[model samples]
Target: MLCLRSRTQDAWLQRAIGATRDILVDHAHCERKAATQALMLLGRFPDVTALVEPLLDLAREELEHFELVLALLQRRGWTMESLAPSGYQAQLHALCRKAMPGKLVDLLLVAALIEARSCERFKLLAEHHPDAELRDAFGGLLAAEARHHAVFVRLAGRFDDAEAVRVRLDDLASAEVAILESMPPLSRIHA
Candidate 1:
């Protein structure tokens, strides 16, 4: 299961469905950000050979998801544009450790939590959203999001013991739940 401490409320799904265009656009931005985050990890830990191939593969897959979202938007005759961030990521990331291997572990765990959340939300959309197109699109994405969550958590374990990583992940997952509660729901993927 995903390490999330709370389930997204029905209210959030209603808001997302009400703003489908914005949600799709925000999802596109989220995919781009996920790919960037994977690359950023690679840059930050160039000497960590174990991370190279997996992170590269993740980044590639994220970009592919980004393209898929873009195509979905295009098919709807909608054009992509910038949207204000929901600020969820900044709040979650602010809790990361400032130091070395700890930083690496925290970063990986945070990414896992993010992907876990996305997978959860995508499942809701895939199952409950009224639009068949959106439902099918989200269903297509569900497995990859789950896989990414596993990848990040597994990579985090490479830097620390299982128990230590679990504790940190639990702490971070609690923080992530708090971050979501503190924010008003929006169409953005993390809002």
Candidate 2:
């Protein structure tokens, strides 16, 4: 199951659907950012042998997803472009502790939460989006997102004990609920 304490609001879904082009652009950016984040983690912890290969693989998959999203945008006669920040990720990352294991644990859990939320949103789009092709595309991404979520959670366990990770995950998930609740309805994922 997703390690989320709350669901994406229906109103946000409607906004996303209503602004499909904007959402598609935002999704492409998200995928690119996801790839960058994986590489960033690898850069941050090169000595952590366990993180190297998995993070490299994640970066590759995320880049593939970015390409896929870009193709989707091209097909719809829309090009990816910069958009304003929604602050969802910033808010989530701000909750992380500054220390070593605590920082690592929080970063992993935060990544997991983002993947969970993306999976949830993709599932919703697959089910409810009006365009059949869009639905199919979103459906295709669900598995990868879910897998990424699981990967991050598993990686977190490598940094800390199960009980500590679980408690921190719970706490972070609660904070995530508040972050999502406070966000305004926007076409961007995690908005």
Best by lDDT: 1
Predictions in order: lDDT: 0.93, 0.92
For candidate 2, the 10 contiguous residues with the lowest summed lDDT are 180-189
Looking at model 1, the pairs that clash are none
The pairs that clash in candidate 2 are none
Could you report the Cα RMSD, in angstroms, for every candidate shown?
0.8, 0.8
Tell me how far the alpha carbon of residue 189 in candidate 1 is from the true structure, in angstroms, after superposition: 1.4
Model 1 CA deviation exceeding 4 Å by range: none
State candidate 2's TM-score. Answer: 0.98
Tens digits of per-residue lDDT, candidate 2, 77-133, equal: 999888888999999999999999889889989999999999999999999999999
Cα displacement (angstroms), candidate 1, residue 70, comes to: 0.4
